[model samples]
Target: MRFWMVFAWLSSALLLAVAQETVLTDDALHKPITVWQRLASLAEVLDDIRKQTGVPLRCQDALREMKLAVYVQNRPAREILEQVASLFGLRWRRDDDGSYVLYLPDETRRALERAQRDDRAATERALREMLRIAREWLRLPPEARAEAMAPFAQTREYPANMPYSAYLMEEAAAQRQMTQEQRVKALVADYLSGYSPQGEPSKPKRDAFFSEEDTQGSLLHCLSEAGDAIVNRLLEGHTLGFSTRPTPDALPLPPRVLLPFWMRHAQLSDESVLQFDAASGQFTEVQPLPNPDWGGYWVRLSAWGNSLEYMVVALRVYELDGKTQKFLNKVDYQLHLPHQEYLAETETWRQWEAWATPMEDWTARLKERTPLERPKPTVNNERPLLAADALEWLAWHTGYPVISDASRYVPAWYRDSLDSPRALLTLLSNDLWLRFDPNGYLLARHKRFWTLNQFEIPERIVRPLEAKWLAWQWLSLDDYATLAAAITDEQARGFTRVRRRGSIQFWTAFDNDPLYYELPALRFWASLSAAQRQRALAGEWIPESALTLPQRKLFRAALYREFPPPEQLLRDLPDDYEVGLYVPSVFRSEGVPESRSEALKQSPDAPAFRVLQQNPVSELSVLKYKDELGRRTYTLHEVKTQVSREGVDWKKVFQEAGYEGEPAEAILKTVLDTILQFALPPRMFEQYILNQSRYADFGRHAAP
Candidate 1:
């Protein structure tokens, strides 16, 4: 019987499962299991109603399993089913038997949707309120409102119920001591009039909205104004009013508001700005004041043992006319250094290294005392004198050559000029005589070389004694004195006793003449018979018949062509002899000589009638002679004399050649030939002569 019962139960479970599947219809199968599936299957109807409408309803899991009648609310079943499907995770689908299948859960789906919707609405309302508050704040004047409201503007959120105006008023009151009504008026005035340090204007006709006078109604206002005046006076005193500090705080009782205003302007909010009274150098009583347009102002005060050390005061005031806001900042600083303290500090660092020591001590001392009262300027007496080794070290460090001229020397006048023993020591230490004594003495005596002009002294000496004498010159004097002081024998003559040569000037003459000669014999030799020329070329056959005086001279001239005389020999030779030899043709007159009276008459200075009558010798010719074999070689010289050419005149030629056109005509050519003779090489001499012709042609063309 137990076996039968177990089998029967399993069969029942399987049947019920099949019935559930068969109940779904073909239409339900065609449709998807979606939010609207509940309306297509009655079994899911009540579950769907609860979910979709947020209403609790009865559900029958056993009836659903058995495929019995499914109950639902009286509301439109389709609507209820749709709502249930949407609210809860339920759906419908068609089964193989053409029956609809409904899936449902226990919870009310519609109630959850309602709660979510309400939450979303409330959030949205809060966001709207926040946005409204921000808009209101933005509409408020920037000068009247605080910067705290800026974050709200960025997020655009506000409290849901509070009025925007009321919020703004609260913010203003917190930042500034002002009532609600007063805040509105002030912000409105600030918005319309822009930043106005003075109170808002009563009448709107004129653009002027406010003045400082209008803001004087409040106690803070009076205090701030009074503080401003006092700080201004302090700044003036520190800078322009007087160099000295006042005896006491002369202004009226410190303005309560002004103290905060000054502190704010100075940026003394940090604790670092203030210090203990015993600290002496510490600042105290730091505070900051609010500025309408530009943040706040800061100020601070510091004391130095028994006296106020320093005070910084400032205020941010808006200038309406200039349309600018500026911090009128001022500082009062006083340094009080007791004499004993200063002396102690000075002694502590008296021997300190020059490079590492602070300049504060030196600068302070300079400011505190007059020049007369201060210690005289002194070179560090303890500094070791620069010996040769020291100097070598310095030279190595500086990378410059130390020359002999930088030797030690002292002048008698230097000894007389010393004002004190310390000064004298400095003079002696720097004196080349003491510093470079042995070396300077040895160089002066043995080398006979002074460092005066050749060697430059190091800057140490050059900067001081550079005006009158050189380093070596001074060195010589110092060494002489030092040597004299050390010498045991009074009779021993010092280096100074040695007479020195004074500077002297001398004159000399320079000779720069070139030798010149003709080569007529060489030319004649070329003209000889080839057999005769060959015989001449051969040493065996010689011209036994001695040459005539003129021929011998010509031969000598030919020898000169091969080998010219030295310039000294040429300069010693008679000028006339040189001219007659190589330059004979240059001196020959190209034209026949005319009487001076006739020449003058034909000159340009002559009367026009006399010029017309005179033939004005336009052409000239000359005969040139040279010594040859027992005969004179003659050559005809022709010169085409230009009378007044169309474009050029004799005056133009003289001017173009940079000549004054002196009467001594041959002298000019002689000088020019002399210069060219030595300046040009033998190969270039002919080219130079040819170039002269080219120059003449250029001059002729250019003449006007």
Candidate 2:
């Protein structure tokens, strides 16, 4: 394969060159210079080589051998001898018996032999020189080189009769004969003519139009005209049949032999069956058969949309010949819907049915002695939990409240922690307030503070509370009833009361605010044990408070002056000092009103009172600072509206906003116009108005 490939490549190259040359003019085919002048021109080359390598050039025979070696190694085999002849300024010709000859100059032969016998360095130098001479000789005009070494350069003969030269000559001749177009035409013609000497003749045909010769010719011609088309068709696939002659002494058909037949009916369920008359091969009746678990013998039929819609049929044939029953089987056959339609249209199925109906009829003829019964289907009914009931149950059990604040309106809840003030605050914010009975029992709750504006709380405590709530909600009714009963009875009368009055309050000393009244204060003072309360009251739990006004101011100044604490503490009181006047009138009058009035009257020479400075109040100042910051930092963009035919002119709006036609200005104007047109809700508007003040300065200096 490899040799043929190389041969094909070389042959193609040679043919291509010939074809190209044939189209060129004579001037384009420059005749190479004769060999002799080329050899003579080598003297200058030898002188140059000697200069480079310090070796004397010698011997025509040695030079010829070096040229031969180089040509053999570098050039392709066919071009080797020709290249050698060109290098030596010689031309080669084959003798009548076919042998290669090399002609060289007399002086060159002697010089080459002398160089060959020298030392290693000398031999290498000599080889280089000869190579240089060969190169120089190759450069000379073909005609000039052919004359210089005519006498000394004669053809030489090898010992044996090698056919390599003959082969090359033949190959060259053959390549010159055919162009690519000519080869294609010849190959096609030969194929069409059916000139194959290697292929055996196909079986002879009796028909007059299909004689052996004619068939072969026609097949070949068809293939030649459409070989690729035929191969492709065959590769795609074809249907063929193989017929074999049956032996004459075949055993009689088995009695009760099982022949599986598939029916391609449009509506045959798995239980559907067709009864056939074996003698007439015709279908008699159609019936549905009960599925049986008999091993190795079964039939399945299915139809579209029905459980048994698409049909697959199988059956076991039993021989019932006198007492000993045996089974005989045939290969299963499938009848597809499309194929069935074709067969039905062609009346094939009718014919097949006519022949097989008797067999099916006979097989199904047996009547069962016992009647079969089908089992009844079982039904179950159960109900799922209702969402409202579930939430109520969860709330009752876990002491948690559900709040719905999301747009989707899905209600969610978190378990309440009795010990966490934050949790209680969250509940209060959501208007889901809770209270305990006098004895610490849970009571009916109010949702005013817990559900109104509740915010998200931490998950760590919430999750446990939620779990407990869920568990309480899911507890068995019997368990809950039992607990309820126990609570109602006198046996549990000492338990915590399920109702408390003062627990829910506002705006008093026990108000639910962080400053003077909060859950921690209540839990610390009222809820803790006596010992714990005492310990906490003794300052272990209480943090030190900053000194009041005048005392603080005086201490601050004195400390700044670096006076010792003992000295500052011992300093005499100012003559006109009045501590009651220095305290805020609200704290003094409301917190210690009677005492403050009495002290003021007794101190008649006290310094006159100074009114407290009132901080400035503005619309922005009245708004919560954090709420303003949140509004500025977290955007509450209005829902975007669809474009209207008379939508606000963005360009005009941008101009009004002091933008001098910047591209994004138009977008910003459009956004603001849309926002203004949408009209926010009252609360949302307040928030937006407040935030706008904070961002107003930013908008004022922003780049257009």
* Candidate 2 lDDT over residue span 668-687, tens digit each: 21111000000011100000
Error of 2 at 51 (Å): 31
lDDT of each: 0.26, 0.24
Error of 2 at 627 (Å): 99
Which lDDT value does model 2 have at 590?
Answer: 31
What is candidate 1's lDDT per residue for 511-619, written digit by digit as tens?
Answer: 0011001112223332334454345434222331333455445334333333223221112222211111122133332231222222232233311100000111222
The reply for model 1, stretches above 4 Å from the true place, is 1-88, 91-108, 135-140, 144-146, 152-704
